[model samples]
Target: MPLLDVKNLSVNFNTLEGTVRAVQGVSFSLKKREIIGIVGESGCGKSVTVRSILRLIPMPPGEISEGRIMFNGENLLALDQKRLRGIRGSNISMIFQEPMTSLNPVFTIGNQISETFKVHQKMNKQRARKATINILEKVSIPSPEKRFEEYPHQLSGGMRQRVMIAIALACQPKLLIADEPTTALDMTVQAQILDLMLQLSDQFDTSILLITHDLGIVAQTASKVIVMYAGKIIETGSVSSIFKHPFHPYTIGLIKSLPRMGLRSQYGKKPLHEIPGIVPSMNENISGCWFAPRCDQSMDICRKVAPLQKYIDSDHSVSCWLFN
Candidate 1:
């Protein structure tokens, strides 16, 4: 069975202005030790969808309008806070985008990491400390003993991120959600972090839901890819298929926007490709395809009727009138 399955998930936020539909009928699955990447622009619901899986979205405004989030045969959406708390960190851990903010400044690295062990594993302080150091070493943080006593502010961005990973993997959870885990790091550090994640995931036999805006990183790391636009999935397929033959106009535009190896702009000889137009507001009630406004190849039908998901092959699917 797939380790994680999210079906027909719709998320909305009730605001003073109006209700904003952030995620609409998003569905996907991930298997053991597999990595799937979700890619899109800033407000495309990549983070919101994953956050919903963990029940991290605040309830005052945000709500799961409809959906089933099944993890290991259990409906996560139905679980109460107590059971969900038990599952979180122990069964499914998440590494947020920014470690500087994620990690508490007052607590030492040792205290922060050992807290995970104490909370989930119920280990004594001595044992938790030992385990924290071991995990620190495993994540390749130098001088584990000395670093354990240091604060989050003392570590470099890469080292701080490693600490976050160590904490998330402390219990060797079955699934790990990495939301833009390498966003602000240098290219070298980013590669190292990605490699470390893959290595550790293999060791732990964990499935990963890697959410990022970088298509290049997804190309190198994920086996499958899901493309989101205007709060809905526009295309999904194996990495090879999505990168090589993108069917959705938005997906194709995203791939084209990546800087090529030898491509350069000298006197406008080879300008970089960019998708035009901003994403529509969530409050706007889009009657048809949300991407129709910005799509250069949009047909009359695209603006009048929302297209259904169509499959080119078992592993590839797209939602576009062109495919119909």
Candidate 2:
């Protein structure tokens, strides 16, 4: 059975204007020790879809209209808040996108990491503190002994991020959700963080749900890929399939948007060929395909009817008029 499965998940935000549908019928599954990457432009529901699995979206203003996040055959959506909390760090842990903001500035790193152990395992302070230091060392945080007591402000950006990882790993959860974990770090540190995550995955045999906008990073790490656009999944497949044969027009455009090694000179070393239009507001009721206005290959059907996800091969599927 798949370790993690999210089916037909839809999320909406009750804004002052109206309900903003953030995630529209997103679905996928992950197997044991497998790494699935959700890649897309910023605000494409990459984070929302993953966050929904954890039920982190604030209520009153945000809610899951329809969905089921099945982990180990249990539908997480049906679980009450208390049961969900128990499952969050014990069965599923998430490494947030920005550590600087995510971490508590006033609390010492050791205190924060130890809290996870205390909450889940009911470990005493001394034992939890010892566990915290050990986890910090495991994540390759330098001076783990001394840095444990340091506040989030004392550490470098990369170190702070590693501490975040350490906290997430402290519980030894079955699945890890990393949402743009390395987005704020420099190139050198980004490599280190990615390597650390891969190593940890191997060590723990943990399934990972990685949410990011970087295709290059996705190419390096993801075994399977799901591309999101304007609150909907545009395409999905194995890494090899998605890279070599992108069936969706949006996926093709994203590939073209990447900076190629040999095309730099021809492109005058300028910025990339960005997708022309901004994502349409959720308040706007898109008549047909959300990407129709931006797609170069748009046809009458593209403007008149929203396309459904059509299978191209055994593993790959795309939502675009070109396929049908």
Candidate 3:
């Protein structure tokens, strides 16, 4: 059975302007020990979709309008806060985008990490501290014993991120949601972090819901790729299929935008390809495809009718008028 299944999930926000549909009918599934990468440009609802799964979106401004998040056959959307808390951290953990902002500045790294063991596993201070140090060592934080007393601000960006990973994996969670876990780090550090995650995934047998804007990272790490655009999933398939035979225009544009190695223009510089036009505002009500305005191959039908998702093969699916 799949570890997580998000079925027709729609998330909306009430703003001063109007009701903004941030995620519309987004659906996907993840199997045990499988890594699925959700890729898209900024503000494409990738974060909102995952945040909704954990019921993290504040209710006053945000609402999960429709759909179910089925994790291990239990409907996460139906779980109450108290029940949900029991599952979070112990069963499912998250590594946030920014470590500095995510970690409490005033608290020592060990104290913050130990709190998870205390709350979720009911461990005493002595045991929690021991476990925290062990986890820090597991994440390759140098001088873990000494670093335990240090605050978030005292550590470098890469070390802080490793600390965050340590906290998330403290309870050996079965599922890990990484929302751009490698963003803003140097390339070498990025590779180290990715390698660490893959090794830990094997160690703990964890399924990963990896969210990122970098297609290269997805190409290297994920088994499957989900392309999100304008608050919806435009294409999904195996990584090999998505990279080599993309069907959706948006997916094609994204693949073409990646900088190729050893490629140069006559002027000794290679120009990168960029998709034209900006993503449509969520507040706007578009009757047809939201990407039509930006899509080079958009037709009259694409502008007039929204295309249903069509299957190219058993595993590859795309939503586009060209297939319709």
TM agreement with the true structure for every prediction? 0.97, 0.95, 0.97
Where model 2 places Cα greater than 4 Å from the true spot, the runs are 265-274
lDDT of 2 by residue, 59-110 (tens): 8799899988899999999999999999988889999878899999999999
How far is 30's C-alpha from truth in model 1 (Å)? 0.7
* All candidates: CA RMSD (Å): 1.5, 1.7, 1.4
Candidates arranged by TM-score, highest first: 1, 3, 2
Candidate number that wins on TM-score, 1 or 2: 1
Predicted candidate 1 versus true structure: per-residue lDDT over 200-296, tens digit per residue? 9999998999999999899999999999998899999999999999999999898888877655543435667888988999999988899999999
Clashing pairs in 3: none
Candidate 3 residue 17 Cα shift, in angstroms, is 0.5
Best by the lDDT measure:
1
List of clashing residue pairs for candidate 2:
none
lDDT of each: 0.94, 0.89, 0.93
